[model samples]
Target: MKKTAYLCITALILSFTLKPSTVNAAASPVQETAKTSNHTAGIKQEQPGTLEEPAASEKPAPSEKPAASEEPAPSEEPAPSEEPAPSEEPAPSEEPAPSEEPAPSEEPAPSEEPTAEIPVQLLGANAAEKTVTLKWDNVNNAEEYVVFFLKNKTWIEISRTQETTGTFSLAGYGTKNSFKICSYNSEQRQTGESSEIKVLIPAKIKKLQTTAYSKTKVKLNWKAAKGADSYYIYGKQDGKKYKLIKTVKKTDARLNIKDKKNYRFKIVPLFKSTLGTIAGTASETSYKNTEFVSMGHQKYTYSEMCSDIQSLCKKYSEYVSYETIGYSEKGRKIYDVILGDKEADHTILVVSTLHAREYIATVVCMKQLEYYLLNYNKTVDGKKLSDIFSNCNVHYIMMANPDGVIISQTNKARWKGNANGVNLNRNFPYAFKRDGSPKDGSYSGKKAASESETQAIVSLTKKLNKTQTLAVVSYHAMGQIVFGDYGGKNQKLRSDITNMYKIARNTTGYSSAANYGGTSNGNYREYLTYKMKVPSVTIEVGSVSCPVPKYQYASAFNRNKLLILREAAWLENNF
Candidate 1:
């Protein structure tokens, strides 16, 4: 029995040993298969061989969990470098979709969409600078803008800029140009266009001049402007700004520059288009000629008086005649403005400005001569001036001592003598008196008829009295008085002189200081009354001192407008 038990124990030991071997042998394939599967599946199989069996034993259920956990490692490893390749593969596919979308939506939109018109505004044209300025609102998607002007029905590009405003030179462009604007994109494609605007480039007036037609009217003449349809005249008086005077279609225009002042005129060429009125460069400022006499605004100069004499002679050539009887000490002509028929039976002589400071009397005589000529056919009192002057001749020695008058006007001095320091009124030959040779104011000459002006007057008076019934009117200044006295004992001559003085006093409302029985001096009135035995009167004008103010001219003119005419009419009727 002990032997039997030993044998059985031995068998049990063999069984245990073989059983472990068999189990180990069976797990070996599974572990190998799992390792092979993990290797194929790209999983890590790094466990030891001894632990392989336990892992292999749980491989069916736990293999899934390990596979899930191991799968993250593989994914994370590739995410560093290789995963981007797969992502980029899909990204390329999506890129085509966006690219295709842009082709249809963005690209074609810029090309096919209706671009709004460019909003352009025309700034004024600078005539002096010869430039045209244009402005426009910014356009969307526009890279730049181009300025174009129409020339010969073709669009010509003038300028290209990115700014909203542009100034273009109109050097070669004409007075009128049609302009338009266009906006361009970065692709160099035109995006927006503007409506055409008509721009007027103002032209310059080349020349201008004014001719005085009357006291109130002036005629303007100018060279035609390059593109002007009309012209506008502007006038300005002393101490005033320019004003629009008139609009004329022709190059010549008649405007009222008015009387009593000097005027400057400007001529502006105008262009009228379908759009607006444009004023061009103005002509140089011009001045009117001496058609109208200066009415006491300033001292009337000798040169101006000489010009007026020539102008009046040309104006009244039919009824007026002039003679340069003699020259003054300064070589100025002594003018005799003769009116009426020279062969008339009666003659009346009106002499003025024998004293230098009494130059205002020359103006009065000229105005009277102009008035008579202007009213030559008009009826005054009961007869026409022509009819009255037909029988009685009237002569005016205007500006007898122009040289001395020039001296007084230039220096504003109270000079009342000839250039030789001779008072012409006291230098007459009829009633001789030896006054001292003072430089100014009432000085008789060295001898009676010593001065050329005195000799001329003396010779003229003697010649006139020989043929006609002569009357004399001597004009002086500073006192509103009339003097008619030469100690003449003849009844008819005294009566005539007194009647003439009465007429003048009544006409001018002046006080008379008649020295009907008084002695004579070397005065012009006395020379005519005492020696020539004709009716004579000395009329003194003005209430102020000599060289009266310009403002006093109106009163002087109104007071003397009819005096000479009335006297001439009386001589024609009675003489």
Candidate 2:
């Protein structure tokens, strides 16, 4: 019985021991496989002998909870491994997304702050004194401010400040004025301009005088009154009153009279209140010259000028060829008089009556053509007139704005625009503007290159060769002046043309009187200088007036003839 009990005990001990060893071997392979899988799945595994295993006797008690227990053991091991990797990647990605989103949201906040502040205001305006006072409300968070003033339809920076209220006084503040303010932070970021404030100064007239020079002519002078943006000189010749001339932004004024007849002169001043206000006008004392006389030529209509030109072209059929360049808005033909030998290579372009009321200029051009054609064989200064024509091609576009001239002559005192209601003088393409006027005069057009007259002139000028077309001369009336382009990018041509103009002015007595030096805009002179690079001049024929009395035309012709002859001679010699 003792031996049997001892054997059974031994067998039991061996069975338990062997079963534990087999179970340990199976668990070891399972752990090895799991560790390999975990490494492939990007989870680090521990070494095979590092982990402790429970004894076989203890394993029986934990068998019911093996899944839960095994899961906790693996999770604890992986927790530390995954913590470093996942923390590195997730922390970087999450932090960047939030940071980027915050930056985008902050971008627009700066733009919105200043829009809520800064208001511009106009305090007072006086046209008689030619001064204005401007004030504005304070802006929030503004480190500095800038003020701008409008002079001659352009905004110029006037002052800058870090304060709230500002006062600005401007002398010679004329018929048009605009004001604006800009706020800035310490960082120098400009918030944008405040609302524009506009005001018009009042008009005042003073220091009007008249001087008689000859039995047939007189001169008028005056001081530019404060707040007087522009001055209009009116004259009465033989009891018929008319606007004789105008001067812009000038103080001193002088006018010459022709014809041995009585004449009366008066001055009118224009004033602007604010930036966008209409001008107000004031008239001064009237002075008279009892010795003024009239020129004897019969008053000719625009139609008459056209008819006579046609007749003269027909009369000289062999030498002159007449062709229509285009038609005006009113459908009147824009005639071109091709003078001189047709075979000549050198071309001279002469344009007149660009401004409708410039009747005397048109008359002068017509007479020039007639004199040149009739006396080409005649010699003056040892130069044959026929030789002049034979060498150069002369193109005379006599009546440029026939429609405008018709309006000016037909009892329409306020007529300064073409049939299309565009100021032909302001219709050119160079520096053209539509809204750059005093609501009274020289409105360019609805847009640049808008007017048909401007288009026609540009087309005609562009067609002429810069080398072949030696020069261009456009004639205006009133303010006896002969001015040409200078101080431009093209120095050689500008210098040459200025010299020619000086000669013309000295010979003709149409000297420069206004301080506002020549700046060509929508005018043919500008086109000739800047675009074509050709020498050009604008000859203001006669003193300030239109129709200039029929009796005065002879004296005007006498004074201007030598100058015109000099020009013709110069063209013939130079080109």
Candidate 3:
């Protein structure tokens, strides 16, 4: 493998080159050519009424009565006192004189001061005010109560109120605060405090972050504070306390701060409380990175596909871009990875695995993407791949039906429909018909393009048509044939399908299906041709089983290497 790069150019001329990362990232090289790739579509607001108090902070209610024992039974009468003369303070433990001649039974000595049950709950979590309101059951004969706030870990009397509820300002208290209340006899401070109500306040935000763009501007972001209605952005200079800079309407605070070199930022959120506005703690930026991009996924799950494509766009942004072109039936993102020059005069759209059992097509699409990007600058047959990209935009729609792909992966069954059980391949608008009921594999969906996957394709093509989409190639598997027909509607195509068919046959050596066309109802290829006025072809990659054996991946790649280039090459010349 010495001079590998040097040999790569010649090796490309004689054979197709395959790389591991390219295969790993694209789909599963052979297993998931186009992998069957969850979505909950909601605003996801934090529902209210989830307020909670600490377990230790909870005060027991005053309704229950104390049990029988009144006092410690006088220590078993001091071991029955053998005639020893008692000391001056009565041995410091004996009950006074036992009443000189009075009997000890029924002394009627239950005169201990009544203790107050502390407050049950605190109000004002929703209060706009800075003070916390204390609430508890009222005790009879109690004239008033005193509230103590924890200060420097020491209890200090904060307020006294005649009513059952009283408000205590968090002001002058440290970040952590707790409170306790005691009932007063006619004079206050007559009894020990009821159980303490510990108040917990957040001290700081979790993760304040900053991302530096290429310019002098720094993009600031912070995790949203729970129950926050809005956030305040603060800035600091020269190590001083951060000053309030701007008030933002979202809990997820984001802004671009520019023209400053040595400075920092802090974020504080204003949470909603009916008692007024409850506030959360503040966050601040720790650091910033200008060149950090995340890694790709190991598996092409629906979410993994989105994250991986996003990573690619960040890392290879100059050559690659991505979009949520549409969604699957279950709302999973149908990500479309666009490569080559966007401003190119011609466009080629590639799709794979409309059939879930044939997800291997997705892998092919992914590997093709990886392979093309790596070799775009290298020459093949005296033509640089980069030069081809300069004139043609290639769009790779990996795993057109994510719902079916996932189902197939999990159960290892034959599923060729979306999560709704509609066959997306047969759900397009053209030649629409009821294929079956919702739970059947051949279900054509209730209406044409009813599935999100189909609609995404429709919407994508409509948008691309404005930019001159010349052709589309949807990859399927287990047939080993490349052909063009939309229910045999090729006669009405804008251009003859003969040349395109020939190109596919030449590159993959798959048999041409023009003479023996495989007809299907409400297919994507038909819709693309008839409605979009764009030539679309279906490449049935191999004649193997549903998954097409892992060893057969090389055959899949060898057959479809020039699939896009050939189509783009044709479009560049003929269009």
Q: For each candidate, C-alpha RMSD in Å?
A: 25.2, 25.5, 42.0
Q: Using TM-score as the measure, name the better of candidate 2 and candidate 3.
A: 3
Cα lDDT tens digits, model 3, 1-575, are 66766554544432222222222322333323212110122221111101111111122221111221112223212233322233222334444475565442212111145554454565654223445666877766677776776667556766777888876776521243567676666754354455656553333455555534322444565566544557778877555677787888754434454343455677776653322444565665533322221112212455555655655454344578887787676777788888888889889888888888787777667667766654565775456777788898898888888888888878646777778888887888888997686565778888898878888888888878887746888899877887664444456463546667778888888886767644467978877777667787888875777766656665677678767876787788777
Q: Give the CA lDDT, 0 to 100, for residue 68 in model 2.
A: 33
Residue 69 error, candidate 3, Å: 99
Q: Candidate 2 on 516-569: residue-level lDDT in tens?
A: 454457666776687667788877766647655556566566666555556656
Best to worst by TM-score, what's the order? Answer: 1, 3, 2
lDDT of each: 0.72, 0.61, 0.63
- Which candidate number has the best TM-score? 1
lDDT of 2 at 161: 81
Q: How many backbone clashes does candidate 3 have?
A: 23
lDDT of 1 by residue, 227-258 (tens): 88888888888689998878888988777655
Which segments of model 3 are wrong by more than 4 Å?
A: 1-300, 486-496, 514-519
Candidates, ranked, lDDT: 1, 3, 2
**Top candidate when judged by lDDT against the true structure:** 1
Weakest lDDT window of 10 consecutive positions for candidate 1: 70-79
